[model samples]
Target: MFNTPGNSKGDFLEQTKAAREERALEKRRDAAAALIQANVRGWLGRLKFSQTILNDIDEIIPDVLDDTDKLHYKPATEIYHQALKFLFVWKKERDKERFAKLCRYLVASLDSDCPNIVMLVYL
Candidate 1:
């Protein structure tokens, strides 16, 4: 709160700055996901899920799955889905000694078994 301007317009500027920061954070997260997904997609083939599905995947899946039977049609659960337990595993390979070594030593040979289930080795 230090050095904040003491005026009504200052409040508006502060709000705008906060909004811009939020947007930048969103962009960074999206970019990070895109890089991971791109590397994954190239390795796994075209992502089985649609952008529409991926776009709202986080928010909509919860409501869509509130009724268990409704999820039957979803590709991740219903089709050639042995590899994808869920979408991505953020456990991070580097966090686990075995995985970290594998990621470092054998990552070149390690391609995704399922395009959808990405174990992010690092962000």
Candidate 2:
């Protein structure tokens, strides 16, 4: 069966049938492999993009908190609020430390003179 010539017509037919089934199985396997790879790439891309966004947020947090009287402060505050909500909701095991550090930084950076800002972070 393994490379030897078939001894009869029935043997040849059986050999061809097995080959066809093997080919179909290989096709299915290839399709599954492709799908798995695509999903993994998408997950990794999203994880990296999320990290980049967090870094950008870290850079702007001080500005958003310090300039409350500016016209943009209101919108920035709203964005900051949303970010806090996101951070608090993030439940990934890998990011627990990062989230905690961000929370600590936010708490420590608050200005006592601005009760609103203080309350916003606490909330």
Candidate 3:
């Protein structure tokens, strides 16, 4: 009987095991990369959404704070929601001082039971 070159059973088994391990390691790396990508995308999406909200708040703050009625009786509920959104965005941005100052301004602006005061405390 003659043995074929490099065809020993032990060598073949070792090659098969190595191939399987390599494939498994590659799969694990791919999965980890994908998970990291997903987390980054989610974080970016949330940041963008918060930025949009913050911009909207900025545009309307002067008018609301000045009570110029530019929005002309723009329901208290809507104003309340805007205030809440502003606080959330500020909190996320770690600007607690600004938020606190804004709250004080809002309270001060309520010189005479401004409907905004009720709106602020409503919830």
Candidate 4:
């Protein structure tokens, strides 16, 4: 029988495990892409707004806000301004008071961390 110095059954098993993990990861990526495509199609068929507006709002909100770990009052304030602009435009077509109430609720939720009285003035 032929044998190599470093080649052992354990090394073969480790290699096999790594390959299996890589295949599993690839499968998960494919599934996620399919799910995203289905969601987009469904939203397009049901919602009135164009894909562009939906994409813009999605991008704008997250881009304006800092990550959870780096969140601070300044970025939060900027996010609030951007959100207000979006909300105002949306409310013109929808319910204004309900939109205002939603804004109030959001401000109240952030009060504990931001504690800036100016936020209430906007409400």
Name the top TM-score candidate: 3
Task: Give the range where candidate 1 is weakest over 10 consecutive residues by summed lDDT.
Answer: 77-86
> Which pairs of residues have clashing backbones in candidate 3?
none
The TM-score, computed over Cα atoms with residue i paired to residue i, of candidate 4 is: 0.34
Residues 1-123 of candidate 1 have per-residue lDDT tens digits of 555556667889899999999999999999999999999978665444433334343332333222333322223333223223223432444225423333332232224354443233434
Instruction: Order the candidate numbers by lDDT, best to worst.
Output: 3, 2, 4, 1
Candidate 2 lDDT, 34-77, residue by residue in tens: 99999999999988877776665555444333343441222336
Best by lDDT: 3
TM-score of 1: 0.31
Q: lDDT per residue, candidate 3, 28-82, as tens digits?
A: 9999999999999999999998888877766554434455333234345665688
Q: TM-score each candidate.
A: 0.31, 0.52, 0.65, 0.34
Q: Count the backbone clashes (under 3 Å) in each candidate.
A: 0, 0, 0, 0
Per-residue CA lDDT of model 4 for 1-102, tens digit only, reads 346645777689889999999999999999999999999998877564544444444454432133343433344565466565555446465546445544
Q: At residue 3, what lDDT does model 1 achieve?
A: 50
What do the candidate models score in CA lDDT, each in turn?
0.45, 0.61, 0.66, 0.56
